[model samples]
Target chain A: MSHMQWQGYLRKDGRKGIRNYITVVYLVECAHHVAREITSRFKEHPVQLIGFAGCYPNAYADRVMNSLCTHPNVGAVLLISLGCESFDRKKLEENIRQSGRPVNSIVIQEAGGTRKAINDGVRWVDWCSGIIGNTMMVPMTVNDLVVGTVCGGSDATSGITANPAVGLAFNKLVANKGIAIFEETGEMIGLEEVMSSRAVNPQLAIELKKSVEKAARYYSAMGHGSFAPGNADGGLTTIEEKSMGAYCKSGDCQISGLIKPGDRPVQPGLYLMDVVPDGEPKFGFPNINDTVEIVEMISSGCHIILFTTGRGSVVGSAISPVIKICANPQTYRRMEEDMDINAGGILTGETTLRDTGEKIFEGILAVASGIPTCSEGLGHQEFMLSYKTFTPLGPGCLPV
Target chain B: MDKLIKIHSLDNVMIVTADIQAGEHLHIRRTEYYFDKPVGIGHKVAAQFIESGGKIIKYGVPIGSATEDIQMGGHVHLHNMKSDYIPTYTYEKQYPGDANPSLTNQSINQVL
Candidate 1:
């Protein structure tokens, strides 16, 4: 048995954070440039940039932004408004203040134009960073952790190595009373029956099956499949084949519940995030790219993300750190600097699945204890947000 | 060690663990076969003869259907295999990736 513990910043809402970051948010696309300038000034500090791109109001965007601003890892928040956007900045600032984090806002149109607003934002971020530096540190156990897994740029070696290895680590985390989430319903088309069979109850199983069906219907309506051409170039023939590889990241643990984006898990176990848009397909696609899914995971309170890649994706989240596990030996050789673990060793007969899984589990603890991931050190903070709609989950969806 | 891997016991297809050349010989599960076409590292090869329109099994489940008859050790890909659940969209038809004039434009209205 390995006895590993981490030191986390304790928040007022009884949650612990692995990374203490001051987040700078833009309410709409117009404020994005100002927010970027403010964040760029703090190059040496733990600051992140995130925002919504739409000027139109969306209930789902409001919920997700609120959840992100008050996320456990975020120590303070700065909202940049263009003086005329539909996102509710007042309510967002109020919620952050209620969570005991310093909150400030600057409207570029009202604050004497561009240069003046940038100066004011810089001063506020400096003050906020100073206050967050003094927060009390608490001993955090595995039970207090919520980890998420997502696969991008997948190929054949993903199923044989990295995905199953992640599943093993997920099983270990859940066995230790920790939360593990595996998302991307659009990528899980054909594995619904097999996945639902592992649900803790029949009601939960029904919800699981329906979610995948919803994704299939939505993508079919879009006139394109969830799979990208990169998947084909990497040798994945069909959606079912990709789903089979992606499903292995869920491990063999019995799924406890289902939740949509921004819905926190009430219990410690395995859960699936339904990334598909509910009702009619209003949005162009459920997830525009990998960063959108990463943002959704952070909004659900994940402290860390396990990202498996075979074709090599180099993206990190705005709040949570993404641990890259490369599944292809050739890709790993070409991009070793971007990967944290070489699961491709399994294909080379250099390591076993259990060993690679244990390595990932250890990597989680190291990152939770303040070790910067490759993406983080390399300055890969990719952020994206778009319009999405969801009717609240059903009662049977979350029994815990 | 085997150069190809059968992901499940019931799978009749094997994933090539490394790039294989034409006229290469492979022995799997006490049976031997010869490849007539080059196969990429991550592509699939038939473990047994698959008749046209038959299901291709992998991970103990059907991934797609064979569009044409495939002999043992034959390379399986988009040219001979296709999805059974939904139409697999390619970049050539969806985007301006290539100038393959044979491809037709697909409308979202038609799919809906």
Candidate 2:
């Protein structure tokens, strides 16, 4: 018998999810109010809302929406659309249906108005929630999990304690044949040489280098690196310094592949998530803030997020639980309620890195087995998606 | 005495493990050095003398170049260094190398 005791919401697509949430989606900004109103009625239930604010159709938006709607964690979907918006609601609804999830769409104009559309959406949700509540919980193990790690609000302590500790956790997770992902290529400006050297193959090493190079070009065009004032005040000096700190979240696993924002890992041991957009920097910053990266990970099928913060952040995500690992002992004390794991003990010489990593690995297992993370318990369901461009991954990006 | 931990064997700088005050001394590798200014936790202190425009090596790689010659035990940070790829920003004022990296940031090794 397996020592682990966890069950997942088994999806028809052969994927299992740790949570079963009924998602309310707004196809365009014009329909956001009705979607929010519908979700507000189900505040006591596992109902969450997400949407694209652009009225002009974007292929990227369509791809992300399809991925999110059919995500293993999503039990059902209710879409709100303005009658003349450019989003392809029919295709989205059909995609969800094909994924074996209940889905419905309410066009405000056809439904007579905002109040009517919201009422209609709420009714469908009320009915679908009952049906999805019966979703089978099947046996899941460490091998069945896809986990992503990201460092936000980082300070100097981040690279030393929490980030490396998270990396250790990744190492073990990959050893156990579980999928692990780490991202923010923009912060990896100066470390490409070292990172590429760790790739599993020469082609992947080259892809890793190209990804970071793309990020460098993108940030240069935007006129600002990911480095922030808080980072500076926290003792991080240059973008390269911040990148050095942020890069450790990947741990020391042999990188398996390079994946773009909406691409899931082909077969995961370790994968680098390149969140930067392709082409000229027309879409502004690759990701405006931290939550955007969280959403991207979720869209790519991450079961959970291990978020390490030295400066402290209190946000989570709509479809996944964010496990907050605080790196600074002082910051952990001030934000105790927000943080889940205190990896800061490494700095005080109270805990060893291996032990902290073991705790984080166990935390991932515990959270997966139905324990609410600090973010989940606090009802923090932050999500964001914006238009960006990308060419499909080259064959060299992911090799067996 | 505060502990300055070197993250890598080749690191020329060490990360301060605790909030430190000016004139506080640290003993590392048989050498004693005193802080020149109050430094917060996570700040870097030079492990050796680094000349202006030389690499600020950490984690065994150069994160950036020093803007001024830093003595052993001196604080190593923004005032004394900047990124070769792009200028780091703070709320106080925007650094000049961001929009035009060719101008301000071109002083060091151009890139990786």
Candidate 3:
């Protein structure tokens, strides 16, 4: 067994959380400033401000909220409601409580006013902090880790370098009995046959194929293949070519299961996150941008996110840490400050893919043990969510 | 060793990756190419001569049917190739976007 180098906050659910965060959540965009004030007042308490600003109720929003509220990292939740918004603060509070975490809800209108709400929120936070300070720490090992990988702003070098290198890291993690996940089903199009074959069960293989086919049909209907404008400039000719490269990130591990947004892995192994909505495209795209993907991974119980970028993305999640891996040597040269690992060294012929992957694996350990990523250190806690919907996974989807 | 060059195994034309001076002999995979002109990378050469409206193929996919007869080893992208399927767009035909939505609930103070 791998040695447990770091101790994490032990939860009643038997999960290890990397951080104990007190979140002041706003129910709608209207309450954001007040929620921010509540969190800002407690700057020394590791308090974070996060919430859904949508007045419209959405299934995707609910899914995201459910997963996030119960995320292992969060120890206490304080929901700030405008009192008249569509957001179901009751449900959000209930979910957090169900996770055995401390939760409080304050409706601003019902609480008298903004000043009273913030004061009440701060007092609640202070009391929660005293209680949270008593949670015990448990030893954690590699096998206990839930890691997610996402490749964004990709170019030709992405498939050949950072993506495949992350794949190697994923394989290593899975070999260590850790839970590994990869998303962006639309990018995995043309390689479904190759990908499906890696599923642990035949039923899962069929589900995998169906998901990719659905994504392809969806994109085709949009009159745009997952083809990006930058893709042509980077020398990728087709979606199939991109898919073949993107699929390498899974590192030949047996796909233990398939999950939709906010679903955690049932067993430790490799998993594919189907980011495309079920049925048709009613809820817009699966993710509005890459930050949404990172948020989903964190919600799925990931302690850390391994983000690979060819063109480069500086944004990180509001919760879990994002370790950005740079794929292109040129992009790294241009944006060194935004990158965490220079997988681009592979393109310069200075390092092998395995070497960079090992570097990333080491980086994961460091982040897990409290080392800050570029975004985390720079204080870039970007968050976003839009209206969307999904039908839950079928029995065939989880062949584990 | 015999030289061989197949632009696309399915298409008659071949792409020239290196310089080929006229009368200079070169070998590819197994077939030999007797160069007529020095061909550069991304350049195409005629595998055979044909009249207008002949079909052109690359990588085994029919890029487009030729509008006019062409010779082998000629360029096979855009100018000569046309998509067999005309593209169409409709709002009702929107594709599914990224669906992974995670709730970022940050609960800090109330630790029980």
Report backbone clashes per prediction: 0, 1, 41
Output the number of the TM-score-best candidate: 2
Top model number, lDDT: 1
**Model 1 lDDT tens row, A177-215:** 999998978778867776889899999998998888777
Name the fnat for model 1.
0.49
Pairs in steric clash, model 1: none
Each prediction's TM-score versus the true structure: 0.83, 0.85, 0.77
Per-candidate Cα RMSD to the true structure, in Å, reads 6.5, 5.5, 10.9
Cα shift from native, residue A299, model 3 (Å): 1.8
User: What DockQ does candidate 1 have relative to the true complex?
Assistant: 0.27
Which ranges in model 1 have alpha carbons more than 4 Å from their true place?
A1-3, A226-239, B1-15, B20-40, B43-112
Worst 10 residues of 2 chain B by lDDT: B86-95
lDDT of 1 at A87: 90
Cα lDDT, model 3, residue A276: 79
Candidate 2: C-alpha RMSD to true structure equals: 5.5
Off by over 4 Å in 2: A1-5, A225-239, B1-14, B20-40, B44-112
> For this target, which candidate reaches the highest DockQ against the unseen true structure?
2
- Stretch of 10 with least lDDT, candidate 3 chain A: A232-241
lDDT of 3 at B37: 55
